[model samples]
Target chain A: MLVNRVKELRAKYNLTQGELAKKIGVTRQTIVSLEKGSYTPSLLLAMNIAEVFNEPIEKIFIKREEEE
Target chain B: MRLYITVILRTLLYISLAIMVYDFVRIEQQFELLGRGYIDSFSVNVGNQVGQVFIVITIILVIMNVFQLFVMKRNKRAKVEDYILPEYDASDERSVEITGKAVRFAFVFILLYSFLILGSYMFVPNYFLDFVWYPMFTTASIPIIGLIVYLISFKIIYSR
Candidate 1:
């Protein structure tokens, strides 16, 4: 599973889901999915999101071990 | 200007769909008139031909609108700014994935349903065979059923 600090960082930056999504060339639903951990974005999308947040990709996204 | 173009494209799409519905109704009415002996066979045939032409035109309009919508979405993405655009990327990866899953599920469902339908024809051949267009109707229904299933599954999956 991929964990993300997108929601946290978005909140810190006072950006709404739609705002963040538009800045990254994605839909608001994509941001919602990423925040909810329901969808794993491609490397390009992750990098774009990181750029939008002005942070490193590793800082925004982390891989978590699957829970049995 | 871009927003107006999007609105115009949407309006055209709706108008084309409306025309399709109108043509379908006209065809159905012509068929009914023929059955009631109100219209001759030649008139019915002409009505069907016209309806077919309208259908083709509607299909072309739909395709054009879809292409325009895609272009509009790409433009919006390229010009992303503080303001939120009303456009959506219908062919996004997540949407495509969900649609693929829905299509596969619908295909399996339709296959099983077809088997059941075919099996029923064996026992009630007379009932099913009474309609000369039974096979055609069933064949046409496959895509409709698939579309319904796709929409339902998409709703369910996306809700999560």
Candidate 2:
């Protein structure tokens, strides 16, 4: 299972899903899908999102317990 | 992705049609030369050269079109799979096999053609090979070869 830091990181920066999606060059629905654990970002996309949060990728997105 | 493949194949068909029309005109010119009392073998040689060259070009274009289809399909599938199933890596073994089969089929076809030509040289001395044979054989076989290639590539690209 995948865990997306989208909601938490977006809230930390006081940004809406649309705003976060615009920053990452993807559609709003892509952000929505990511947060809902229905999609996984490519390596480049994940890296871009991590940079937006000013944190390492591991901090924003953690694997679920079942996945571990 | 399917739309992209259809467009590419249609373009290839148009190009092949143009090449065939050009070859037909050239063949008529060769026939005119023969009517003017040229050496008996002159038209045959010229016809053979032009026909073979045209067939080879058409085959090359067809192969290129096939490659384009593969790349387009692969890109679209990769994108969709990335969104839907991140853990599973797409298997490319079928694609590899299809490529191998296409190459092998091409080799076998050429080998058989060569054997037939050599046999005509030995046993059927009176039956002369004409220039039209190349284009006729190629035009006829393109569909056969294309069907085989499409089947293999389809199995490879879509199986997984």
Candidate 3:
């Protein structure tokens, strides 16, 4: 499974789900699903999210097995 | 949800179409039974009623579409028209995948339902004479049922 720190980073940046979604060109519900770990985003979306957070993709998204 | 409302409006549009079709078939059946080449007052009244319903639905859908277009033209990010979503939402990667799964589920349901509908004709050998609405309604119900099932599946998956 892919685990992401989207929620943590978004909180750190003080951005609402809708704001983050708009910056990343996605619907707010997609952000909600991503935070809940029920949806895995595509590479393009991951890149956009990384740009919005000003972080590398690896720092935001990681494989669960790798963490283990 | 806006998505659900759109789906409901679309379903109503479909129902209006089915009603119009039902009115047409009923008139045809009347002609067959009476062996006449003319339409009667009751049939015309039924046709007019169905026409009115069809026109109402068409107007609603058209108004929504035009409003969406106007919103897009005025402001690219005016979310007041958010309810005017595209046919399948496809708003993001997650929704695209979910919509795809819903379509697949609907496809499988339609395939099986088609066979069942065909098999039902075996039991009703005289459907033409006895149950005139059976074929008309069932044919129309295929897409209606598929849309309902798709909507249900999409909602369940989206909530998950």
Candidate 4:
């Protein structure tokens, strides 16, 4: 599974979901899904998110083993 | 201007759908009346012709409206970098995921429902055919049920 610190980074940047979504050219619901871990974003989206937060991709997203 | 066009197209689409439904209901009523020996054959033919015209116009309008919607979405996404877009051809990934899940759920629901109907028919062969309108009602309800199932599932899945 891919886990992400999107919510944390979004908060650090003091950006609402709508603002972040607009900056990244996505709907606000996508950001909500990303934070809730219900949707796995593409690598390009991950890079865009990293770019917005000025963080490394690895720092923003982590790959972990699935829990049984 | 784009929003205005979209709104107009949507309104027209709804009007076309309403007209089609009205036409269908009228034709069905005529058929029922004919079966009861109340309507003449010439009247039935005229009603069918009117229904056919409405069906053709509605189908054309639906196709045009869908094309317009696709164009509008593509234009909106054109502002974003091409490389940044998702793998799917649509506007966003999340919408695609939600749609995918919803369609899967609806497909399964329809499949199960059809199987149940088939199973019931094996025991009572004449049950469905006894009512002339039953098949039409079932056919019409499939899409409605699918849409309802999709909306409910989408809400539950996305709200979490």
lDDT: which candidate is best? Answer: 3
Q: Which stretches of candidate 1 lie over 4 Å from their true place?
A: B1-91, B127-129
Off by over 4 Å in 2: A7-18, A26-39, A42-44, A65-68, B1-160
- Top-scoring candidate (TM-score): 3
* Model 4 spans with C-alpha error above 4 angstroms: A66-68, B1-64, B67-91, B119-130
TM-score of 4: 0.64
DockQ of each: 0.45, 0.04, 0.71, 0.49
**Candidates ranked by TM-score:** 3, 1, 4, 2
Task: Give the winner by DockQ: 2 or 4.
Answer: 4
The numbered model that scores best in DockQ is 3
Docking class of 4: acceptable
TM-score of chain B taken alone, candidate 2:
0.35
| CAPRI-style quality class for the chain A–B interface of candidate 2 | incorrect
**Pairs that collide, model 1:** none
Each model's TM-score?
A: 0.65, 0.33, 0.81, 0.64
Q: On residues A1-68, what C-alpha lDDT tens digit does candidate 2 reach at each position?
A: 67887898799899999898888766575676678776666777788899999899888778787734
Give each candidate's interface RMSD in Å. 1.7, 10.9, 1.0, 1.8
Distance (Å) between predicted and true CA of B148, model 3?
Answer: 0.6
